[model samples]
Target: DASGVEAVALALVINSGVTLVKTIPLRRFEDAVRFGIGLSPVFTVFQVDDQITSSPHIAGPTGDTRLMPDPSQTVGLVASPGWALAPVDQLDQDGEPYPGCPRTFARRMLERLAGHGLELRGCYEIEFFLGHRAAPGPDEADPTPAHTGPAYGAIALADVEPFATALIRAFEEQGTGVMQFHPEYSTGQLELSVPHSVGIAAADTDLVVRHTIRAVARNHGYAVSFAPVVFAERVGNGNHLHLSLWNRNGRNLFQGGRGPEGMTREAEAFTAGVLAALPALTAITAPSVPSYQRLQPHRWSGPWACWGRENREAALRFVTGMVGSRPDAANLEVKSMDPAANPYLALGAIVAAGIDGLERELSLPDPVQDDPASIPARKRRSLGIRQLPASLTEAIAELEKSPMLREAMGDVLFDSFLATRRAERDVFEGQDPEDVVRAHRWRY
Candidate 1:
């Protein structure tokens, strides 16, 4: 019951593209519960240099702090000693919605969807790498990979059994369901599939899952990296989102008996909207410079803006259900995402884009039955398939010019997000590749 616990950690995802945590003594939990914790609004615009600034004039040293906790999200930390996670709501002093808040954006999107008689159900398929930190000393060697894999070989699972077993147990204790875990193709890489939940809960569960994995890895004397590409030469980690839409009547709106590939009209429009918006969506879903390193063609990171049935190489992969689940199990897997992205923003942008498609009644294009990159360049263009933004700078440019995304995220959020991303890109653009990886490898 953690009866002896002396503190609770309140975590918030800030505009800096990272989670900022504040620990309050247990005795003060009541005070927080009563009046809420004071937090500087400047945190929303903080850059890696601790500067509170953003483009289009968002620099602030005058706003008051507001941190309201969601009591329902409070959960015990089974992996970290004497710790607990309390997700907080960020707002302004006047109790108005903070345009910089990702969760606020997500809630607004959900509300918009509800207005259309639809709901979102989804989960994150997380992949990460475990490495061993060398002994602390001036002469310490570089961190060593935990396992060398033969690409999902049985031996790979046995190699990390102790850590994997503990991680699964901790996830269960923390109320985060684990559907499956396996070794990925890359060295030291492992993938975990979590059970899906609806809307905001799904994002909440993703935060818990990532936190649990990092905590459990630390407990085992290892370091875990959710960076998109841990090594330049190997397959990178991805945080793929599997999403489905449901109607108010409890029916899977994505299922259609007459639609192509068994996708309902609603699902088709939703997917078409997502595909159309993929170029700009890259700024949010694959938000880091290192993310672009992992999004290249032939790498299976959804390098092309196309959809295919069970195609890993396409940005959107439509998965068909098994016997027990049947049509209800069908969902769209967005493969161009990674863990560096804030789940709230990523999922929110996706829903908003899909809704835009639905509102406009957009039509789905023909599914790419083969590898998108394999097709000739001229032919690819004929099929309306285009390469995703290949760099963070390029992606941010698309995002900045995207009226749909700007409308979905609001001007304040959209501008601030771009400023933050631009700041990151400016820092990494001319830097050495190793230096860049070192800077972000452990942060995400």
Candidate 2:
């Protein structure tokens, strides 16, 4: 029992579950987990070419056309401990947390949670698509759809056997801790489920998984996209996050029994806080333009901010089993997030909001009884359930106005993210949904 507590606490530092091998030595694990040195802001340099002439009498003549160099200084990489590459030096010899890394954002959020004497536990259910990068033709049927034995579908798995085997092996090597890989409802859709971990470690595992999946798939000449709306008019990918909260003493604070939704006072407060901050959180969860394409009604996407027991239609789903059990299973699945969204920043925003609710004693709202989309628009509106941000523009606006989100991400990261997101949104402003997906599908 105490092992579980130690595991949970240690897991806050590393991404995957700790496993020991018969052949592996204990000393090897000393450097097995790569916990970086520290978090400090980095600097950036810009090269410029334009030159101006100065008066000889006032100041020394700056050679306008001679060998003069012009340089500009800009804010360097935003530092977060969980980042994979160092933030400032994109080309540094040693690996550092990559810029725009979501894991770093989540680490920052965990730091914030520490300030309030709290801890977090999280897990991710990620969905994606697997396809041949260089097929015979765009119109030709993929010959390698199921090139191996059919684990699920006799015909499909056999066609794509090689791809499946290679991907699984690669994932294992990368320490992704992949629980299962299965064919989804769509033709090429695949889902990867991973074991849960506590605090920033869980979020970091997510980052490693996402990057490894895409990179390994590419090495096999296959392209993958976690875009929620990857296939036009077909089932899209979703990055549903399972979240829970704990006190500093290692007690799960979310387990409750008497509430209308089977949530405790603290749980209710956390949920209420998430609901209160969701309008802004969407910008991080569904950052891309195509994200809104899946957030529409009647698509099993969680457009409405309604929570209920086993209700997939609601944005927040209350997952329960029976009586007062483990709070680990008594968490909420935020279904609004997509694969393209940065997991770190998105999770951080949500955790910050939930912690805010606990601090302020916010009251939870009534859970929806029926399908929110079918409850009639006016009725749904009356219940205080509104559709999430329909586009990146609206989502950004909501984020800009949320003081909680701004404070959680800090000024450097918040500003850099907004700037980068604005640029991304602008480039895809008029592109078709499918075009947008095609251009950015596997880049993440």
Q: lDDT tens string, model 1, 422-441? A: 88888887777766666677
Indicate the TM-score of model 1. Answer: 0.95
Question: Backbone clash tally for model 2?
Answer: 20
| lDDT (Cα atoms) of all candidates against the true structure | 0.83, 0.60
Model 1 scores worst on lDDT over the 10 consecutive residues at 48-57
List CA RMSD, all candidates: 2.0, 11.4
**How much is the lDDT of residue 175 in candidate 2?**
46
After superposing candidate 2, which stretches have Cα over 4 Å from the reference?
1-105, 135-176, 215-221, 322-327
Model 2 weakest 10-residue run by lDDT: 66-75
Give candidate 1's error at residue 353 in angstroms. 0.2
